[model samples]
Target: MDVSMARILVLTALAFAISGWAAEEKPMLFSPVSEEPEWRLLDSGQGRFTRQEFENRLGKIFDPTGAMQPYLLFDDGGVTLFRDKARTRPLYRLTFVPEGGAGEVNPPLLGGGDPARPLAGKVICLDPGHIGGDWADIEERTFRIGNDAPVVEGELNLRTSRRLAQTLEASGAKVVWTHDGFEPTTTLRPADLYPEAISYLLQGSLGARLPKYSANRLIRWNAELLFYRSAEIQARARRVNEELRPDLTLCIHYNAAPWPGGRVRLTSANGLVVFAHGSYTAEELAFDDQKFHLLRKLLENSTPVELGVGQAIGEQFQKQWGFRPENYEGSGYSHASGAGPYVWYRNLIANRMFDGPVVFVEGPYMNDRNIYPWIQAGEYEGVRVFAGKSRGNLFREYANQVAAGVIDYFRRQAESSATFTNYSP
Candidate 1:
């Protein structure tokens, strides 16, 4: 057999084995076995949110009546999240809910398209993580000096996304963006949804950032507005599911460590961490739609491909930039899919809510002594040499690597499915 042909056969067999394994397994539960900072299991003693906390937060985004009371219920003797509702089926059990709402775009079958433009006819969505620009501070995605220009993550990621879009479009792939610019896609800003949004902050880990209980209402409220992270992300999820139905979604972000005192400072950490949807917390599992989403994720056999794309991107990053995969000692960094060291299975909002496979790319730590300067260097035209290599501007370099990964992944998929005109497997 030909060399590529043999590789294709091996990959196909592996995919089949994976799909079969997914079919055979029972619904797995999330139980954090370690106290590592990354080992997070919702309400599993170390989770970021408790049952009450989750209920309140979920309510702010999904329910309001207190009617859906404890919309989420934990069996650890915690109270229910929403009120009892009349239903055809029970609310909290592990039953599969058929996917509804907007239609989804699955991976396109290859073969009839131009081999040069391997991504022809594919719809890809590039979601630059936060609502940036003027809203950067509001989104908590900016690092800055007192009065000088801020290093806005949203702006940088958007630039990278636009560059990636150009590459994809040049290769005959149509790309959609979750947000065109800094402005959010949500119907209402956090200011409009103030109290509820504030309630969430005051109740969760971010609460520490709030003023003391005795602080004046106006002062506390202003502080709460700074942490509108969840609401904004949920808005993006709504857009991903309802509007931009792409074959795949890439959530772009520049990584950063927990800034001490919520202030950005120079840090030694610098690495790439990519997430491709696994690690479903028990809180997420309790929801019918989430359960269905998890089931579909496993059955679609997309995780392997997601990992493949992630690995491809990681390799390109390493080759072009001196970036390395993030490896930490915890379940946060665990659940490796065997496709690559950088790829992980984190149950983030984008990973859980997007209709199709989501590859969350957490780029290099923005505060790294070596990396921070590049972020501040802004954009430039044509090629520039950095770290002993010639490449496009920083954003372009990032975009090129990601675009190369997507192209490579589809090329392999196309070659593997050479026998069929519309084979998704």
Candidate 2:
């Protein structure tokens, strides 16, 4: 063979050899493809998973065009994945011990595993309030008490969380949740604020390290896994974003008040209102402002209530519902102007501690007699009707308006963060 031909053949063989070696060196947990497309479950925790299983999972998760799938996976421990643009970002890594196993299974490092690693991409944390049991306890069993009111708040929160998660996931965003369905509380109180509380919760031992506190000490204290045993939730959220620092953190929740006769309303007010914590700093205030802008827009679109009409609605509820709107102060009907436990809790944790933009939606009211029935029925579509009849749905046209606002915020963040080269179409 000619000298040039021989050299070209040798170079081609060397390239193939390097490619083979690189493939062999890569961790087995990650797909062979570097494009990192969205993956779907083929068998779903079924039979022995081999290379074929992996391929099938990939096929199911992705389309024939080989696009990344938007989905999340969580075992008993904390393990999450966000598939997009042919790459998977690890949200959290867990060491799982199989039943009767001698040792644990350490998730192989694929994208990244360090807890302090920057988030690979954007993340959405959905905090679904209450639980299914909360609904049964109130609606079915008729167990009414302090703080434990009805499960309506929890149910609505969970439903909306699920919907939002599904929507965001489809859009290629990593999503995690604080609670799925009333799991055992594993949160711990912080040692600094309540050393005794933390010690007591951990049985005199530090089960987990706490996140560093910034200006919001109450947020830090409340963030403890012990106070409400929400530490595990916080840890999971932190772990997933460790390597792939999320671009945003969203806490989904419904509003509630103590009054019995108020109707639904929206709020434009913004500030830090921590439930576990008492106050906030300038930075926290800025974050809350961004979140308020996002949430106010979202609620205006989702809820039938009209913007700048809370006072009008309050007046109408008193006249028509015959119950004082003031009485419904804590039942998810009042705006930010009114004080309630739910408001305090939502304002504190969601707005203060999260580094990214955060916001909470007071889904719907459960205390107002006219609104409570629809909520119990899980009939959000009926909300538009109620809003229209009551002049609250006049804001429906603003749905696109609010959605546009969120899109603009995200576009700005993307431009600044450079996290995604392009927004998902």
Judging by TM-score against the true structure, name the best candidate.
1
Model 2, CA-based lDDT: 0.35
| Predictions in order: lDDT | 0.61, 0.35
Candidate with maximal lDDT? 1
TM-score per model over all chains:
0.67, 0.36
Position 395, candidate 2: lDDT: 20
Regions of model 2 farther than 4 Å from truth:
1-121, 130-150, 185-244, 259-347, 379-384, 387-405, 412-425
For model 1 the local lDDT of residue 232 reads 59
Query: C-alpha displacement of 164 in model 2, angstroms?
Result: 1.2
Model 1: per-residue lDDT, tens digit, 1-425? Answer: 24553454456447656767352232222211101111112222222233443343333322222323434444553333221233333323321212332222243332345456778988889989887877776566778855546788888899889989999999888898888787877665545654443333332422236444433343335433533454556667677777777888888999877776765577778788788777554444444445444434443435555777887787777776757777643543235555667776666766765666778899877778667767667787777665565656778778888899889877777666665556452
